[model samples]
Target: MKERKGLIIGSVIMIAIFVLMFIKGEPSKSIMVWIAAILTLSIYSFLYKDNVFYKFAEHLFVGVSVGYSVSVVWQNAFIRRVFDPLFITRTYIVNDKFSLYLFLGIVIPTLLGLLMLSIFTKKQAWLIRIPIAFVVGSYAGMGIAPSFQANIFEQTRSTLYVTLSISASIMIVGVISTLVYFFFSKEHKGLLGKTANLGIWFIMIAFGASFGYTVMARISLLIGRMQFLLHDWLGVIK
Candidate 1:
């Protein structure tokens, strides 16, 4: 009964707003603008309670995002990298002569890709492992150096760079204490126990800051939608 009453109230408010816009000659002429307004409202309806409108908007957003991603990958990655080089332009032919280096580079990867489709066949299912292993091994090899450089080396360098500063001293202590807290080899006793307690305080402060940042980002998105509705759609604000 409460849900029904809330739904009716929401519907009346939406209709009243649209009617007012119509009266003021401020109704959006663009079909796309109307669609955007409706979808935005549908998503925002979840603030009151979950309903069919919110679900529809959620599903539509996900579906459109996935479809767009696939289309982009197909056009930009596969078509440009694989198809165009192999069959269309035949760029593997260096000068007027065939280049073994270019040929192997393209053909080998293409064969491995085709091997992935072998999973569809019962007898050839094991063949898929070959490409899978290759992909995993190559990606891990490629990712390791960059990830280590960024996450470890760069972070450590930045942390210790301004060692004289108060913030840097706190970060240095935080890093050391946090490392000690995770060192479970010996029982945390005496000084170790004290350090670990300090680590807990640092960890809680970091987590609280991260959570607050995330909340502010979400609130910013909400404010953006409100601005769009008030200024662009309703013409209530310039």
Candidate 2:
């Protein structure tokens, strides 16, 4: 009985909002605004309780996202990168003659991509490993040296301060104490133990600050949505 009452109330509210939108909103953009408003409210309905409206909105969101992603990848990556280069080249790289390297580049990757599709077949599923290994190994080789230099070497270099101001001194102490806290090889029972406990305090402060920042970001999103509903949809606020 409660569920039926809630459903009727929700339907009435939706219909009223749509009618107001049609009356007051721009004819060109009102339909799109109505759709977005409906979807937003459908998602928010989950806060009251689970219902068919929320489920429908969620499934529609996922389906649209997937369709858009596939269309983008096919247009930008496959057609532009692979198909155009292979068949539509007018310029030559080798002494005004056509370049074989361009053709080989497209053909090799295309063959490997096709081999990856072998996973669908029971007998030739092992062929998928060739493309997988090629992709993984290529990315790892390209990324490792740059990542090590940027993350490890540059960070360590930046921590070494020549002149110790108040801020630099605090940073130095925090870095040393944090390192000490991780040193499980030594029994933490002396001055080392005290430094490690200080490290724990620093870590907790950092975590709390991060959580506060995340909460503020979520609140900002909520504020933006509320502003849209008021100013754009209802025209109650400028």
Candidate 3:
């Protein structure tokens, strides 16, 4: 009963927001802005308790966003940017001059769409492999270039450097330190071991600083949302 009440109340507040903005408001644009603000803030109400209300609202929001994106893409990109340019060329239009790349753009998506249809048919399952291979090949090519640059080259570049920048020196020391820390393979009891211990501290401090910065950014967003609700939504502040 309590959960139901919360759900009902929350839905009413949400509906009121939409009604105020869309059906009966002067400067509907301003009301729409507040409606968005209130709806966004409502998600945080989950921290207070578990309820069916929150679940429904969350799923509803996700469905709406997905549907909206598909609608916008159809209305704007597919109709205006693509369909209009390709098939509907009228006055001063040269269909014979159309680029082959535009055909590839259509075919690639069409191929993927066809591959997805294969899932619904038992005999056509083999057709899925082409799109899968294309996607995987593209991903592997992207992954290998970055892995080579960062892990392979950057990690080993210090040994060949005649003069080092601060960043390079840091990287070199980090590499040397890691090597020393793993000296269980032999024995690191000299200055090498000591340098490795210092490197371990640098790694720890770097991670800690990164974590602290992330927390500060999230807190800043929270404060901004509060200010919006108080000042802009309510008109309670000058």
Candidate 4:
């Protein structure tokens, strides 16, 4: 009963809005605006109650997002990296001659990519693991050295070697306490326990700040949507 009433009310409101928009708004742009408005309202309908409108909007959003991502990847990754460099520029070859080394550079990765499609077949499913392992190992090798330098060495150097000040001293204390809290070799008792307790305070403060930042970001997005409806669609704000 409640769901039926809500749906009827929503339909009536949407129809009335569309009629008003069609009468007042420009024909071509108004049609697009109407669609944007409907989709936005459909998404917001979830806040009131779960219904077909919300589901439709969610599925449409996911489908469009996935389609756009695939197009972007194909153009940027494959077309630019593989097609342009090999066929157009032919930068990998010299004197219009075949070079095994140059050709293998592109061929090996291309073959590995094609092998990924073998995952659909039961017998050749194992071929997919070769490319997957290559991708994982390549990323790990590329990422580890820089990550170790930035996260470990640089942070340690900054914490220990930074000029002494109130803020720096606080940071130093926080780092030590946090490390001590994670240290399980010695039991967290007496002085160690107090330091660990201090670490808990620092952790909670960090978490609270992060949560507040996230909340503010969400609120900003909500404000943007509301502004669009009011100022852009309804012309209620300048």
Best by lDDT: 1
lDDT of 2 at 203: 83
Candidate 3, residue 73: Cα displacement in angstroms equals 4.6
**lDDT by residue (tens digit), candidate 4, 1-238:** 9988998998799779766865665443476766887899899989778999999999999999999999999999888878887899876778978788987888789889989999999999999999999999999999999999999999898888988789999998889998888888999999999999999888889899999999999999899987777556665556
Q: Given candidate 2, what's the lDDT at residue 65?
A: 100
* Clash pairs (backbone) in predicted model 1: none
Please give the distance, in angstroms, between residue 148's alpha carbon in candidate 3 and its true position after superposition. 3.1
lDDT of candidates 1 onward, in order: 0.89, 0.83, 0.71, 0.86
* TM-score ranking of the models: 1, 4, 2, 3
True lDDT of residue 169, candidate 3: 76
lDDT of 2: 0.83
Please say which candidate is ahead in lDDT: 1 or 4. Answer: 1
Pitting candidate 2 against candidate 3, the one with the higher TM-score is 2
RMSD each, Å: 2.9, 4.3, 7.9, 4.1
Q: Write the per-residue lDDT of candidate 2 for residues 153-226, one digit (tens) a residue.
A: 89888899446688888888888898899999999988999999999887888899999999999999889876
TM-score of each candidate?
A: 0.84, 0.81, 0.61, 0.84
Per-residue lDDT of model 3, residues 1-238, tens digit only: 9998998898789768755654443432487766666576567667657666677668879999999999998888667655665567522244656556766666566568568669778998888888888888989999999999998797567455737588777766776777677667665667877877877787788799999999999999888876665456554444
Tell me the number of clashing residue pairs for each predicted model: 0, 0, 0, 0
lDDT of 1 by residue, 36-90 (tens): 9899989988977899999999999999999999999889977988999989998
Worst 10 residues of 3 by lDDT: 20-29
